[model samples]
Target: MGKGGKACDASTQNRAAWLHGVNDLRIQPYPLPPLGPTDVRVRMKAVGICGSDVHYLKTMSCGDYKVKEPMVIGHECAGIIEEVGSEITSLVPGDRVALEPGQGCWRCDRCKEGSYNLCPDMEFFATPPIHGSLADQIVHPGNLCFKLPDNVSLEEGAMCEPLSVGVYGCRRAKVGAETTVLIIGAGPIGLVTLLAARAFGAPRIVVADVDDHRLSVAKTLGADQVVKVSFNKEDVASEVEEIKKAMRKGIDVTLDCAGFEKTVSTAFGATRNGGKVCLIGMGHCNMNVPLTPAASREVDVLGVFRYKNTWPQCIEFISSGKIDVKPLITHRFGFSQEEVVEAFETSARGGNAIKVMFNL
Candidate 1:
């Protein structure tokens, strides 16, 4: 960690990567508002490029969230705490932490029930109207930031954001020591899910992906089997058979990290009777799959929104050596206009680049 700075004063210069419009990103000055009693000013260090970030960059929208105004464009971030608010006691200056991006309205029923990720009024960073952390500095709620243990690097700290998705997905699917798991897609989310499933003590895990590089990465990450599939839906049946054979056992759970129609179909076909299929991808918002047969077989489908109450466990996983996310970070960039463009391009093009990060 670097030396901490003072609070946002007249001398504190803040700049952010702002998405002005579709394919339009600019590095410009961002004025900081006064820090509230529970806020902490974080000196941004490492921020990763998520699929949704590139989606918003290229098309100006992701799902229903549209970039109506110039908003900062990053969320998977880790930083050093430079200034703490008056009422804060959990963290202090020089603390390295991973930030949980979404902020829910405390008054919502969802928040009261501990399912704040479902809150309708949630203001997540880099989601539509909310500004993100791809800046030199930003003030955020201290409670949202989880301190990094000594063993975790800043980049690995940033990875806790994606790792949370895997942890939550595994939790939803109920993967455990007795469960045989199959993971569809070998992208970042899929890889993290593989790690989470392994850490959760899944007896056997198989990963399927369309890319050889991704599958190879999965194999190196300790997947029992890595099966390759084509983009064509025609390969679904044969691919599922291959996956079943590779597992050599009934798959109790299947995580469709790639939400294409074929992937979902394969997940249904491969999962054992009375098994579970968890949908963790956003590749397709709507798809027609063999639902009736899956329902007849009692293959329950599960859905995952962002994540809820996962950061602490994610940090514990990284620090405990139960999950190693450093290998998934395949690229890095500095905070420059050219590097920003290159970073997003590498991530959006997505072949070999798994996790693209920025070192501010």
Candidate 2:
């Protein structure tokens, strides 16, 4: 990699990647493009294996979005700046940074209003045609790249992607010092939501998951209470009742990171009157929500797309030691292209893994 006033020999051919179909990913050589004036070239160091990556690998799609053609498959990544564009002033060679994969048209009203995550023309990485950061190097707009503090490692820097989602969820839900928060899934996002809620000063936090291992992780992460749900149970209402009994008087806010019908129902039933439900998971695009009853109780249902303007706060939270994400990284792999594929497979199967990360 080029850095520190020295240029390493450029590869004769760049290593490009493609996802041919479900369960089929291939890496091949291709030509690298020269940096644009507003671009920064980075050598990827660590990329976390996300659930969306697993879904695309196993089914070649996520919800309605499908991988119709070969596409690169990663977005959560941290890297070292190998080259900088002419107009870039805040970064240079050798700077360690985290990449924000979503690129939106700056002319849109959403972008101008600081809600670029909702931009209709946003081109996000690893979401079909748009290439991601799984390869050896990537060229991205300089502004989307976030500089890391001296105390944060590259692996931790990569976690800022998911952490931003948690931060955004908390913001949307308006979790506060007296709020009783219930997180409906104990996956990375759910657990991170718990951490964010705690950092936001929420008084009580309860987490639920079908996986015992994940619940254990949530307990370790300081969840006030943990509920284990059975997927095979015919009546999830009883399970919801049990969780409510443990939490006492239901919760003030519910965050559904599972995105399943059962979990959504549970959230609707368990959330106290006038509470909020934040939907963060993408399990089903169109599931039946208990809107009538929720409305009668004055519940506000909120939806979260990607995060906007949250990376800086997440980075600051991690750097200040208010939130610890090191324990969330349950597994790690080398940066080899093959290892990246394996990590995604393991994450998809969901066995004894919490957060799988790739070290480049």
Candidate 3:
């Protein structure tokens, strides 16, 4: 709320939305760390609320990570460089960039193998103990910040963070012009996957979800067909048939954006023999599915963690107009205490809200 008169603090002029505990989010002063030799000081411009951010706010946890202490909550963010370290020349002050949140420990074996996303020692922003990029200013590694193209806005630059997941999933599934795709969840991730698959030259893509509005959004986002699905486990067989009919061709790959028992089973039933079922969503950590028959049919189940080396590609995809993330931004709010609470509540009470943004 304090925007004009000596806001934030006398020493630290940065304010952030922090998650203290369950349903306890507050706007408070956040002190920025000194810039490192290879780091750049960035003034944040646009940040998007993610499902994980909502989870950490409402429940104080997402997956095995718990919010035991206060932490700034936002990862999908874009900012303008305010200052650059002496060691950096690739980026300069006044450059707009999208920040890749995760910084892998270069000493890890996974980093050496170029699979940095799997590094156990990754320091991901807004993830548990790691404070995120919701503040007015942040100091991040210059290498992790990719310069946004002239055609890309700050909001679209923020979209690249979540869009990276879809691109990485498609890469794992090997989507191509001859491949047919079926995405089994019309949430934000599912819709992004549909866009990524299309950009990867998928000839056909079908999307299914329990919500009709999300299905409609998927259809409008270039999905060849959208089917209304059910969450009930017993209805999976019938739902699979419906999904098959919607596709009208055997699914070459199934991206199960909803990691539920029912959704995974439906994917197994709908995909053709030798197809790949890529599990991207983390709806349920422990789900029971029929794996024996799927294995017998040569359907391989692939797993993907966070993305690696995908920020530049996502930026290009947006800059080239191959993927349109503007329609996905359903709501926007300013960086104020009251607006922060409302923005988070709007995201948690999801209906038609696909992506929520914050203009700092």
In what order do the candidates fall by lDDT, top score first? 1, 3, 2
Q: For model 3, how does the per-residue alpha-carbon lDDT over 178-230 read when each residue is reduced to its tens digit?
A: 99999999888888899999999999999999899998899899999988977
Give me the runs in candidate 2 sitting further than 4 Å from their true place.
Answer: 1-12, 232-234
The Cα local distance difference test for each model comes to 0.90, 0.84, 0.90
- Model 2 residue 332 lDDT? 92
Error (Å) of candidate 2 at residue 207 is 0.5
Best by TM-score: 3
Q: What value does the lDDT take at residue 59 in candidate 2?
A: 86
Local lDDT at 330 for model 2: 83
**Candidate 1 clash pair list:** none
Better of 2 and 3 by lDDT: 3
Instruction: Tell me the deviation in Å of residue 88 in model 1.
Output: 0.3
**In model 2, which residue pairs have backbone atoms overlapping below 3 Å?**
19-71
Candidate 1: tens digits of C-alpha lDDT, residues 1-360: 110121234333678898998888889877676778998989999999999999999999999888887888899999999999999999999999999999988898899999999999888888877888898998899999999989998999899999999999999988899999999999999999999999999989999998999999999999999998999998888888899999998999999998888899999999999999999997887899999999999999999998999998999888899999999999999999889988999999998999999999
Candidate 3 global TM-score: 0.96
Candidates 1 and 2 compared by TM-score, better number: 1
> Could you tell me how far off, in angstroms, the CA of residue 292 lies in candidate 3 after the best superposition?
0.4
The C-alpha RMSD of each candidate to the native structure, in angstroms, is 3.7, 4.1, 3.7
